[model samples]
Target: MAGTLHFHPNNLFAPCITNLFWFKLHHHVMVQFKKYVESFPVKPLFIVFTVLFFITPSAIASVQISRTQILMGDVPVTLVVKTAKKHTIKVTRAMEETFLLGKKLSDSLSEFSSASDISRINRSPSHVWISLKEPLSLFLLEKSVKASNLTEGAFDITFSSSNKHTSWADLAIDKHHQRVMKKAAGLKLGVSGIAKGLIVELMSHHLTKKGFDRNLVNAGGDVYASGTWIVGIRNPFSPEQKPLTKIKVKNKSVSTSGLYQRGSHIIDPHTHQALGKKEAPLWASVTTIGNEGPMTDALTTGFFLLPFHKIESIVQQNTGFKVILITLKKQVIKISH
Candidate 1:
């Protein structure tokens, strides 16, 4: 991304300060005296000075520059910054590197550490317990499992090729020792859901440290914004659908869960069945905004299973978050901060 800034020196500082310290000091006094003179000024001198001050620096100091792309998360990511071009580029590069490393760490721990990988680790049960090479992924998985339990199993990480029951909670994380153990055989872990958010958070922190005033990190659909950004909540029912509304977001995360994508991927853990039928009016899509991505992910999943009345309570409990639920009938309900 590239941008330009036109700086008018007259708007910022006096024009005659371009030379030596003493000359600049004399220029400041003269400008102050000129301002006082202008208060009772002859019109011609006032007009001439004003035009010189305003136009000169604008022509001299206007800047134009381009920003380079920085790859982040599991893919390449780029964001536009309107201020501090050089610093923004450096920050973006650092964040990109951080996100790439974080993804590598997450992939090593979970993606390659599946049941198939475990089968190759060893053939013995007594020594089956293993310590992950990367512990942050393990921490993210722990948080996901806890969220799953809290949301009454609406958000689950477990899936089986044979269509059987496998719970992530059954796996134990020894945080002190940085190890994990499975209670039963055939239990596997996948960190796909929560890893994106972790990567976004990491990048956001990196950019903030580098003094970029505003930035956004979007991993597929999961997004984190450091400063003000506009979001469009999609309308679920329309064939020619548009975003139901525009929302202002800052330093927050937004996640949208819907039946439109990967139909029935989310199953209610308690019943071990997809959410198909319900007693109350349900939305086709639900978009949730919150301080953390994992929480937003969990809440969006849970909200899909809840009645409209229940959603109010959920929003109330998590006060800082906002929610927009788009029904199958094309109706929109907004819960705002």
Candidate 2:
């Protein structure tokens, strides 16, 4: 069995990187072999085979699985995972565990359009103590409030609900009793901004915990890549499905939000209406990279509504965060910290 580790880094500059990588590998191999083999009479054929084994790709032991299912209304939930060699069973079980975990969160967070625990709470009368009975819903609310506060209501979900006088601060959580209650009658919880990304985030964590390292979880374009992955940002209006650009991610999470594809669902938390100009929005696309699901998703949505300066401020304050905004005027702005 070939047990040597192999490295493959695919990206925009693949040829250049590959050449440099291979050169370094060969140099190291030759130098090490010359040093060690000089003390012994080693066959030239033996050195050749040793070097070949290290250079050859060992994908025979790798496994990649992708499955798309109807989840969270009409949105397609896709999970793609690539595992190390000889770990097919490990990858499969990790998939089952992560998807099941994601489904549980999705079912609970499907309240904006579907009936759920959070939805029932939204439908309840004023001051009703909703029994979440699960930590995920509470987590959603916590993240929602945190994002709303961080963005200064720019990423507000409470307003997106067809209710009135609801703010992130009005919601009260009884951590001791494990329940939540709204102060006003019209408050509703919407999780669209953060839910999908969070699912991918949780799935990523689960995969890591299960000892599966190389994987990619794309919850409707919001991605959490455990290892390296080349992700294409699909053009919204292009029927050809061409990627606007490719991004290479390693142990990172990325999200792209736009007035394309599911643009109808992206709502301005303040106006509680779908984003964009109905025909053309001020900004056509937003791409964000980071590690946290809640932050990446919420920030992408929030940045869509924010001015360029505000977006700049955000990137400056947060380390390891980068954003690219493309406007309707064909201007592209990139911010990183």
**Each candidate's TM vs. the true structure?**
0.67, 0.76
lDDT of 1 by residue, 76-168 (tens): 444444344335456556556655665554445445444323232223243256665565655676777766765566566654312356575
By TM-score, how accurate is candidate 2?
0.76
Per-residue lDDT of model 2, residues 1-337, tens digit only: 2233444342111222235566577667656856786665666777667666665466455668776666656667677777656677767777777778877778877776455667877777778787875677788778788777767787876765456556777788886777888887677777777888887788888888888677777777688888888877766556267777677878888888877655666776666667654534557788889878877888888877888888888789868888888777656677888
Q: Where is the poorest 10-residue window by lDDT in model 1?
A: 115-124
C-alpha RMSD values across all candidates: 8.7, 11.1
Model 1 bad stretches (over 4 Å):
1-78, 84-106, 109-128, 161-163, 238-241, 262-264, 270-281
Q: In lDDT terms, how accurate is model 1?
A: 0.62
How much lDDT does each candidate structure score?
A: 0.62, 0.74
The candidate scoring highest on TM-score is: 2
lDDT of 1 at 299: 68
